[model samples]
Target chain A: MLRVDVEKQLGEFSLHATFSSEGRVTGLFGASGAGKSSLINMIAGLLRPDRGTIVIDGETVDDTASGIHVPTWRRRIGYVFQDARLFPHLNVAQNLDYGRRMNRLAPDAAQRARVVELLDIGALLDRRPGKLSGGERQRVALGRALLSKPRLLLLDEPLGALDEARKLEILPYLVRLRDEANVPMVYVSHDAAELRQLATQIVMLRQGRVTSFGGVKVLT
Target chain B: MLDISPAEWTAILLSLRVAIIATLVATPFGIALAWLLARRDFWGKSVLDAVVHLPLVLPPVVTGYLLLLTFGRRGLVGGFLADHLGIVFAFRWTGAALACGVMSFPLLVRPMRLSIEAIDRRLEQAAETLGAAPFKVFFTVTLPLALPGVLAGMVLGFAKAIGEFGATITFVSNIPGETQTISSAIYSLIQTPDGDAAAGRLVIVSIVLALGALIAAEWFAHRATQRLHGN
Candidate 1:
């Protein structure tokens, strides 16, 4: 479960969002500049909330009153940005292995092989990120995030950077991820259709406020 | 034909030693300062940046004099170091290295800072979310990406240290074998009546070293550009 009640002031806009979701995939649905990214960023611990608390999996990751703010790395979360920010110096295999090495987790060849096969990225392992196509890069990014064994996965417009054909190419993989992966996810997108297909619950936002919250029907 | 005598060879070897030692010693401090300048915004940031670049604009002789006062025998830091650690920098090869390091620092830091600045900060955030702490992110992501620039900086610094004349001469007084580098040696040779031939040979050596360093720096810069482009 994820709980968030946070207030932040950014220039002229103010964000006072409050919601809690027990859904396996909570789709944060909103238009551009509607604070969708900001809300998810707060959950990922990338952006600190000026006020209130965020609890992920019974752990209070952030609480302004108690001054409990867990840093991002310690949050044990995975984030996939719109731009696939792969390390240029590393090949795909190394990139996938990075988080495991950093976390000092014992090498799990089984899990690595499973994720690679799931994403169909085995052939691309030796290639540099620069060699991958747009869809291929997103798949690699997704695989990289999954291999970290995060408690929660936050994807901000993962498809936002892709073209229509590329989006079609990756949506099936995402659906498989939702059904197969044990980790809960917070998928943020402005596309209602995409949310309708994936989100078990929807939190609708407009101008930095949660205007509505419910099942996929709320997207309409 | 290059007919270099033993005295000239000593100066050449001394120059290489001073330059190498200076470059190696200053690199860690240079990388730290470069990262600080590139990735941070804090109080006194501009002031720190200006201080890092001070050697480039300040007269080398003035920098040397300041070093002498601060690190000379009987001076503040020098006195403490000598008394406690038995390390001395006054009128010695080590003093020449110190001077060269200071003189070459700005050149060493610029490329590193620029490369660090060029990195996509979002990538660092990605690393953090992937369970790498801030320092881990630096070692794994930021430093590797900025390696070409680091190499460029080191080459530039090494070249500058090798050719450093004014500050080195002022700080260590151009003592042969102890402090006289190629630049100082050439200075001495050119001043003597029959030393023109030796000076010419040393000048040729200097030109070759400078050209080689320039080429290496250029190559590193090219690699830096490619790395940034993710190619």
Candidate 2:
């Protein structure tokens, strides 16, 4: 379960978003500059809201009234940016293990193996992020995020940087992560194709406000 | 008798020592300052950034004097350090390092800050969503992406330290066996009769060292960039 009631003012464009979701994938659909990213950023704890309450899985992550704002690290959320931002120095395997190691995940090799095979990045593990193609990099990023075992996965247009073919290639992995990982997700995108193929819920935004929100059926 | 002249070898060894020490001392500070300037938005950040770069613009002698006033025996911080910790810095090799580190700090911070700022911060945000803590995101996503710049900064700083003359001479004074780095040795030799031969040798060494630093920085930054571009 994810609930966000955030109000932030960036210059004159005020973002006041309030929504809740418990779906496999919740799409924050909007046009460009519609505050979808900002909304998602608030959920990720990257941007603090002026007044709001964000509760995830019955945990009060943020309640500005109570002055309780959990830091991003403690949020246990995984975010995929529009651009696949992988560590350049670290190879694919290391990048995937970064959060897990930092968070001190248990010494469960079985779980690690599952993530590697799930993303099908076993072959590319030894290669550096700087050496991979766009599709390959995004896949590795997805794998990295999944390895951390995040309770909430925030993908802010993760496919935005890829070409058409790369997007097509990587979209399935995202969908699989949505279905198989069983982790709830908040997805931000303007593309309808991804919404149809992935989103189980939809929350539409315009000018930084939640304009409409309903089932994936509304996407049609 | 040692095969190498005491003056020549001592200067060589001291130069290397001072440069290494300066690099070690400044690198971590440089990276931290760069990251702060790049990522965090706080009050007086620009002022802090300007202060970090002030050594580059200020005359090295002025910087040395400032250091002296702050770290000198009778100086504010210096008096405390000496009385409390019994540590002495004036006219010592450590003082030379202080001078060198100050002179080279800007060269280290600039490249690093620029590279860090150039990183798409959204990616770091992404890492956060991936359950990476702030520190983890920095160590994993941000630091690796900013690495090429960090290496460039280190090289630039080392090269700058090797050539540091004004601040070092003013802060430490060119002692024969202790604080006499190559540039100071060259200055000392130039002031003496028949010392042109030694001065010329030290000059050549300085040129070689500085050139090597530059060449290495360029080569590494280029290669790292290529790798970053996935080529």
Candidate 3:
């Protein structure tokens, strides 16, 4: 369960967005500067809304009335940036292990092995991020995000940087993550094709608010 | 005839030791300051920016005097350290390092700030959603993305420390093998008619050291950028 009703003003642009969903994958489709990223940032707790409330898994993550705002790191939410910002200093293996190490829980080697196999990135473990190709980098980024075992995932244009071939290669992995991983996710994108393959629900935005939000079958 | 005296070699070694220590001591501080300037906006930001760059703009003597007032033996903080911890810093090699670190801190911080600012903030937000604490994101995402700048800053700081003279000499004085450094050595040599050859050798060494640092910075920045973009 992910709910957001955030209003923030970034300079001249006023972001007033409200939405709620429990879907496995919810796509937020909007043009550049339409406040899509801003709304996403609010959910991530990186940007504070002037007023609103966000609840995830029945817990109020952000609420102005109660003055409760969870910091981004403690939100149990995962976000994937458009450019796949993998750590340059860390190799592919360390990059994947970062979230796990940070979770501070006892090491779950069996679960770790499953994610490694699911992502099919075991072979690229020893290589540095600089050595991987565009598609491989995105996969490593995806694997890194999943290894954290997020309760909710936020992907902000994860495919925006790749070329056509790279997109094709990584699209299947995202689809698998959505369908099989079963984690609730918020995906922001402008490309119709990507939404077609990955999004289960579509939340369209124009200006700074949601224009329409419904099952992807409507857009399809 | 022997090329140099034992005192001369000690000065050389002392200079090297002080500069290295200064840089090492300031590296973490430089990164933290850079992160603050780049990521957060708060009250008196402009004042902080100016204060950090004070050593770059003020005369070395002035900077040294200020350091002496704050960190000199029997000085404010220095007095406390001397009284309680028995740590002495007046006219010592440690004092030289303090001066060098202060003088070169801006060099270490500016590049880091620029690189940190250049990084996409969205990635950090993404890490946050993935259950990364602020410190973890800093170490994993923010710091990694800003590595090029941090590396460049460190190299520049090290270079600046190596070349530093004014504040070092003013703060610790030219104490022969205790506080003398490359630039101080060169300055002392130039004062005498027969010391030209030694000064020239140190000059060549300076150039070589600076050139090497620049080359290494370039290689590191390139490799880091490639690794980040997964190129």
Candidate 4:
């Protein structure tokens, strides 16, 4: 379960949002500058909310009134940015192993193999991210996040940087992730079609406000 | 004409020792300062920046005199250190190294600061989301990515240290084996009546060392640029 009721002031724009979802994949649908990213960042503990609380999986990650704010790393959440920000100095295998190392998790070869197989990134493991195509980089980023064993995965337009062909290539992998990964996710995107295909519940935003909340029907 | 004497060899060897020691000792402090300057904005930041660069612009003799006051045997910091730790810098080779390190610090830190600034902060955020704490993010991501530039900085610092003359001579005085580096040795030789040939040889050695350092710094800087491109 993920819950958020937060107010933030960012210069000329102020975001006031409240929503709770237990859905496997809660989609935040909005256009650019619709505050979807800000909302997701708040959940990830990257942005502190001026007022209100955020609860993830029954744990109070952020509560402004109580002055409880869990840092991003301690929150045990995964984030995939739009640009697929891979560490340039590390090879794909090292990048994938980074989260496990940082979290002090025992190396699970079975889980590693499973994620590699699921993402079809085994062959690319030895290559640096600089060598990967856009689609391949995104796949590697997904594998990197999944191997971390995060409670909640926040993806901000993972396909936003891809071309049409690359998007088609990666969408099926995302669908498989939704069906099999077993991690609850907050998927943010502007395309209604994308949300309709993946999101079990939809929260629509416009200009920093939640305009609608419901099933995928609200996306239309 | 190319013959080198034993006393000249001592000066050459001493110069290398002073420069190598200075560069190694100053590196950690340089990296820390560079990261602070690159990633943070605090009160007195500009003042700190200016202080770090002071040695670069201040007259070398003035810097040396300040070092004398702070690190001399009877001076404030030096007196305390001498009484407590039995470490002394006044009129010693160690004092020469200290002077070289201070003079080379700005050169050492510039490349490091630029490299840290060039890193994509978003990558650090990504590391944080993946469970790396702040320090881990620095070691694993920021430091490694900035390594080439760090090397460049170190090489530049080493070059500057090897050639440091004014501050070193002033701080430690030109004691023959204790504090006389290549530059001070050359200065001494140039003033002597029969010292032209030896001075010429030392000058050539200094030229070679400086050129090598410059080339290495250039190569590392090139690598730094490429590293940022993710290649």
Per-residue accuracy of model 3 over A162-196 as CA lDDT, tens digit each:
99888888888888888777788899988877897
Residues A1-220, model 4: lDDT tens digits: 9999999998898999999999999999999999999999999988999999999999999999999999999999999889999999989999999999999999999999988999999999998888899999999999999999999999999999998999989999999999999999999999888889999999999999999999999976
Q: Write the per-residue lDDT of candidate 4 for residues B64-83, one digit (tens) a residue.
A: 99999999998999999999
Worst 10 residues of 3 chain A by lDDT: A81-90
Instruction: Tell me the deviation in Å of residue A153 in model 2.
Output: 2.3
Off by over 4 Å in 4: none
- Model 2 lDDT per residue over A1-220, tens place: 9988889999989999888897889999989999997888788888888998999888998898999999888888887777777866667887888778867887568887887888888999888777788888888878788778888888989999988988888888887787788889889999977898999999989899988889987877
For model 4, the local distance difference test gives 0.95
DockQ, in order, for the candidates? 0.81, 0.53, 0.54, 0.84
What is the clash count for each candidate, in the order shown? 0, 5, 5, 0
Ranking by DockQ: 4, 1, 3, 2
Candidate 4 global TM-score: 0.99
Give every collision pair in model 3.
A77-B129, A77-B130, A78-B129, A78-B130, A130-B227
Tell me which of candidates 3 and 4 scores higher on DockQ.
4
Q: Best candidate, DockQ-wise?
A: 4
Residue A219 in model 1: lDDT: 75
Off by over 4 Å in 3: A8-19, A27-36, A106-123, A129-134, A157-172, A189-217, B65-80, B145-148, B182-224
Question: What docking grade applies to model 1?
Answer: high
Distance from true position, residue A43, model 2, in Å?
2.0
Could you tell me which 10 consecutive residues in candidate 4 chain B have the lowest summed lDDT?
A: B222-231
> Residue B226 lDDT in model 3?
67
